[model samples]
Target: MFPDTPVTSAALSVATRFCSPALLNHCVRSYLWGVMYGGAHGIAFDDELFCVAALLHDIGLTDAFDSHRLPFEDAGGRLAWVFAVAAGWPQERAARAHEIIVLHMRDDVPAADDPEAHLLQVATSWEVVGRHAEEFPARARADVLTRYPRLGFGAEFLGCFEDQARRKPDSAAAASVRRNVAGKIAANPLETHQG
Candidate 1:
């Protein structure tokens, strides 16, 4: 379960409204993965901040929030910043949400510098391409997957990134496409594991 605050609730509402079924599951699973990883690793982070960030991290990938020029993560960060401010968060805290959301797309967020961002980055990567998948307990992974399910997320996510890359060739998504991330997603061990 995630934080039950009004802000967190609003984040989930936005996700449910805009995201495809598979994308919504990916967002939720990323949060669950982050929480479980934080608990297992003793890395402390604000649950509310982390949960809201995770739920809205992929908002820019949705039709409602996608941008023609900006990277999806950057667009999504601004959207999340507005949502946080509207939910009565202080500007500083709202900025933190923006930071976490924007940083989730990066590969090198240091946990000591930004635990929530670091966790979100790793968790989302684990959910998508199975990076760091072996670090999480198999049982926890099974339960989360059972509740949310992959639901063809691999192909769906690859399509999203591919589209983003085509639209914004200078974006991080384009870089991912250049790296053949689609192949990696398809061959992910976590996606094929029977746990």
Candidate 2:
């Protein structure tokens, strides 16, 4: 479940249609990691709200990937906007989240100014690079490297994500997910798959 925020049912419906359960769950876990990292590093965000934001951040992936687009940055933002409205998130909040999601994939986005924004970027990057890197068709990887070199914390964030994923939501399924992701990234060409 997400935080007690007002998001439109229509938006939520669209989100459900767009994202697979596995990817959605992965985003949720990534958001959880961001919350943990914030506490560990003395950074704080509206954890509940951000968790909600991160959960729906990449709802656009279905369309982007379906269309066979080489780059996901712009598409991710557009997807966020579509779901933000459908889910009933406040206009301003959704807008901000959209911008952050778009910039989240880019290395040039000024990450130093806002901690929450930075957390979103860090969390999303970690989840993708760690769990989905190799599985992520080569074109997507190439797109990421070419379009978002500055927001390039993929390796470091994956390490942090794997460490965090090992804990929380104790269950065989959770552990399996962690192990699977760790294994995928471990042998990946990206950052030596250090996690």
Candidate 3:
């Protein structure tokens, strides 16, 4: 359930312009999954911030935003920070959003302090790697997938990561791609046909 606020709309527009259809769908599904996970965990977070973070999390993977030197996650976080500042969000809120985006790739997000970051981390993990999928209700998963079909997101995203790795061998994505490309690709839930 994406909000219809101006900020949310702006983030979606930016994502749509830069991200492929499959990646954009993944972003939307990431938000839905984050919200669902937060609700299930009884965590109270800023839904709007979470929405923006989810929509823009993988933005650096887009050609327009990709930084050959910076890790894709870091590039995305920096881009989000600029976007939030440009959108008239307060400096502190923008900084928080930046932190959330940057830390989403971590194995353990510091959720004890920032529940929003934790939700985004787990939500992305669930969408990308199929982690904690069973914890959510089956109907909710089906509804989300039905609303935003994967559309071959797994292959598309893998290709994006591979390209990023090729361009920036020292970047975090490159390191990840180097470590286990096949395993990562295999773990992608979107790669499987869900009906």
Angstrom error at residue 133, model 2: 16
Best by lDDT: 1
RMSD of 3: 1.8
Best by TM-score: 1
Clashing pairs in 3: none
> Against the hidden true structure, what lDDT does model 1 obtain?
0.89
Global lDDT scores for all candidate models: 0.89, 0.52, 0.83
lDDT agreement of model 3 with the native: 0.83
- Give the least accurate 10-residue stretch of model 1, judged by summed lDDT: 186-195
| Better model by lDDT: candidate 1 vs candidate 3 | 1
Tell me the tens digit of each residue's lDDT in model 2 across 1-195: 345545433434555566665554556555655665566567756654465557666554454332233234345566666666566767787677667665565453333566666777666555554533333445544544443332333344344344334443342223434556556544445444232
Please rank every candidate by lDDT, starting with the best. 1, 3, 2
Candidate 3 lDDT over residue span 53-119, tens digit each:
9999999888899887888889999999999989989988888778888888766775678888899
How high is each candidate's TM-score?
Answer: 0.97, 0.54, 0.92
Worst 10 residues of 2 by lDDT: 64-73
lDDT of 2: 0.52
Which 10 consecutive residues of model 3 have the lowest summed lDDT?
Answer: 186-195
The TM-score between candidate 3 and the true structure equals: 0.92
